[model samples]
Target: MTTSPPLIISVSGIRGIVGASFTDDTVRRFAHAFATELPMNARILLARDTRPSGENFAAVAIKALAEAGCHVFDLGVCATPAAKLMVLELQAHAALILTASHNPADWNGMKLVRADGIFLDAAAGRRVESAYHRSKRRTGDGRVESVARDDVESRLLRRILDVVDVDAIRAAHLRVAVDPCNGTGALFLPRLFEALAVSAHFIHDTPDGQFAHEPEPIAENLVDLSRAVTEAGCQVGFATDPDADRVALVGETGQPLGEDLTLALAVQVVTERRKGPVVTTLSTSQVVTDAATANGCPVILTPVGEVHVVDAMVAEGAVIGGEGNGGVILTDVDPGRDAAVGIALILESLARNGRPLTELAAALPQYSIEKRKVSCSEQDLQRALDGLVQRYPEALRHPVQDGVKLYMEGTFQCPWIHLRPSNTEPVVRIIAECEQRQDAVELCAVAEGLLRGE
Candidate 1:
């Protein structure tokens, strides 16, 4: 018998493989539950990435929301960040984006946004989850309206252009390569490059949801993008996940600058101009910390989630914030991970510094981060984490509120390991970083051994 992946219900939202755990019935029920929590006839925004199942799932959600007495304004085929920006621009009461982010084409999920244009925080998310399980559907005269993709795209582009050094970038006359992985970024990156007067080469530009490779913008998956950069003589290469919320980069020499450096480079740009605290998740690379420190900016570490980082960004008045996994958040534009904004900030850094991407990356403090996952029951996960605590008693530990993060030395930039249960998958994720690749690999191996009760 073929078993399906379990549905991932987390603070981020619900994600699962389509036609199995996540079906039309599942979509309708969740949509109804989401709507029942809103005001009667409340204004809501709806958007979806280019997953093959997204169109149908979105229709199911639209019907459920309208039947539950909410007006839906649909932004068909749009980036996740675009959907977020439109929520504020249109003053919609709430928004629901149908996307599974970097997950494969067979997967789809719902990301619920509050009125403030941010993903639901833990408390708000809990409310939605509770409603999903307990609330019943209601009916009223509600309607669906179409919001043009151009408007959504323009609003996002203008936000990014407003903050970046457009003049400097234009003067640089930079050539770039983009691989949107046949997803939402294909819809808007061309327009953005045109506006910035950047010469761009695009691959996997089709928005047909049939991904050219794995949807994740990791180094191994971006070989084509790297080749495009070198062959086309581009200064940098950008690869965005399906919903365009995350981006990984390829440097001028066709070298994949792992996702962690994406935030480090952006931090270098932002902290150079704006001197405020920088916020990042605990699992983010220490290079980001080094970048912030070099610019005399304070660094704040949050639990491993975008909402956690965004919350800290708001409280600390952070000039910039993001995750290690190629997610960048600039509160000036949106309090969410935005690939468009990340791309713009990176380009501006190259332009203002008059440096190549490879050189700029090399100048930052370097660290090697290795990630691995092991499937385990929750009880076993807790047991292994307990064992780690006993084994690393002398190590400086973090808050333990989110996960177990401990630094070998009593400092922020030292070799470190973090073990946390995955909210998006049925496994425990182990991340470790060290000054050398071999050390990082060894650290993860240790974590894996502990996880296996060895």
Candidate 2:
């Protein structure tokens, strides 16, 4: 029998195609590593999304943690952020979320959180990976047993409600449309909307492990959401990925508001209420930077990933943070990405501004960004990056991070370009930001030319 490589292990967690990179043995190894890294007798929180294989992976993870002598609290079929919140609410030493986020239904993975509810950074992830690789198997007595599920769910929901002004949201009386993509968000979002007294139109809200569309909430995949929002005359439409860690919005006019706007709007909401530092990944749109600056706040840029952004947030004591892909991180609630929190924050912004969702979104600065990926082997990646750097030496600003990011000055059209290799795929992703779409597209073409040795 052929065995797959353990679901792409790294600083954050393991994620890969089900029955391929992720299997029971792989889950056990990684969980054991996590257990070893955490303190002995540590109480760990475990939760899974509504994937067909989630329960199997969760079972393996629980048993591994238990065998490592850790107490486990299992919350079945919960959003990724909910697991993080439970870690902080329950005062557990760590939390493990079994989800693949926006990946296909056939994929499953895990995200790790510390006791403080922050995702593990690159260095910490490496440590866990090393431990996973080195750990020796110990016999029985180290397995997870069931705990109280209802109590945990109730407490988690209450914690979420306490952070937002439920009455204020109700007063707005905004009609909202939500598509959970048939993931774990379906488990809690309806109850949350009811508590806020908002009228919600739901699609793909069942936890059936059957995705109504592509699991990603990107613009191309949100056509139904856009139509539903306009047809229902909803104030706004929100869609979450499989794990519910990220969210995408559709404007009232059935127009898909880019994912970057989600973060931009959330930043506007949070910074308006409480002025503080904001953090976002480098690939994020400048709208977030503009929003933060307008509110007398500075935007901190990190490498592309939730953990990197959260780490910067913690260091800067940021009030709110998020990524370009619609993942909002509210530090006051939990440093991890939370789609539910994002919905409440956006509604709060609307209520406070006394404006419609479209109007609020229209007020932000506009810019164009184009993203493209090219498949390349490891050798070709190194060669292409070297060539690009050599061709545009004057434009280089930083190169020590995940990939090379260039800042265009002088008469150059685009403002910036970020080129990074994918962690999960054999592709190099190039993102260009400019004042015009044509310029951004042209820059991507230039990047492709360089990669192809043209």
Candidate 3:
């Protein structure tokens, strides 16, 4: 039998195509590695999204953790953020979430979290990689167990209620529409709204692996959500990816707020309540920075990944952080990217301000961001970065920590252009932010041209 391609491991987590790079053996190996790295007799939480293959992989992971002599808490069919919440709620030493967020349905992988409920940073991830390569062995009579279904949702709800004003949300008498995109969000969001006493209209809320539309919450893929917001005549609409860790929103006007606004709005809410530093990835829109500045808060930019963002948040003592892709992290609630937390925060902001979602979003700085990916061999990336630096010497400011980000001074109405190579995929991502859509388009075109050595 042919061996599957090596799993793609990183600071964020490990992911690969199910049958190809991510196989049963690979899952076991990684799980064992994680088990070995965790403290002795430590309790570990295992959760997965609604992927068809997740149960099988989760089973393998449970066994591996048990064999490595750790108590396993099986939280079947939970959102990635829910898993993070469980880790903190149970005070488990670690968590393993089986999901491939925004990737195709056929893909599934594991996201490992530490005791603090944050994705492992590069240093921690490297330790796991080292342990995997060393093939460390531990012997114990540990066993795997399942969490009671009756306890799951209630426990999650309690954590959520602690941070959000459930009473205020219910008093607002909000009618909201939720689209889970056939992911794990379907499992918790409905119950969350019910507990808040808010009327919720659900679409694709079934926790099935089958996806009704593309799992990404990008504007182009959110046509159904936009229409649902209008058809349901709800005050607002919310959508999440397969894992439900990321979220996107639609206004009462049935207009998509775009994913970037999700984080910006959430940040605004958090800063308004308690001003502090915020964190986001480099590829995020300038609107987030503008919002932070307006709130008299500074924004720290990290590389593009949840791990990087979380690390920065911890380091900076940020009160709020997230990526522009609709993933919001509230340190007041949890340090992980939590869609549920984000939704509650947004609703609370609406309740406090007594404004429609559209008007609230419109109040933020407006900037158009365009993202494009180009196929390029790994060998060509260095040359491309070199070329970018040489070509835009005067206009370029390189923060080589992540992928190369180019700051074009006064070139466009917006601040900077970031061109970063994908760590897991064989493509370089070009992200340009500007006040004008045409300017963003032109920036992407120019960056793509330069990266391709045109």
Q: Which is the leading candidate under TM-score?
A: 1
- Return the TM-score for each candidate structure: 0.98, 0.93, 0.94
Model 2 clashing residue pairs (backbone):
11-125, 67-142
Off by over 4 Å in 1: none
Which candidate wins on lDDT?
A: 1
The Cα RMSD of model 1 versus the native structure comes to 1.1
Query: For candidate 2, which ten residues in a row score worst on lDDT?
Result: 136-145
Q: All models: lDDT?
A: 0.90, 0.81, 0.83
Runs in model 3 deviating more than 4 A are 1-6, 133-136, 396-400, 410-413
Distance from true position, residue 418, model 1, in Å?
Answer: 0.3
lDDT per residue (tens digit) for residues 328-388 in model 1: 9998898699999999999999899998899999888778899999997887788878887
Q: Which whole-number lDDT from 0 to 100 does residue 236 have in model 3? A: 89
Score candidate 3 by lDDT: 0.83
- Give stretches of model 2 more than 4 Å off: 1-6, 139-165, 410-414
Q: By TM-score, highest first, what's the ranking?
A: 1, 3, 2
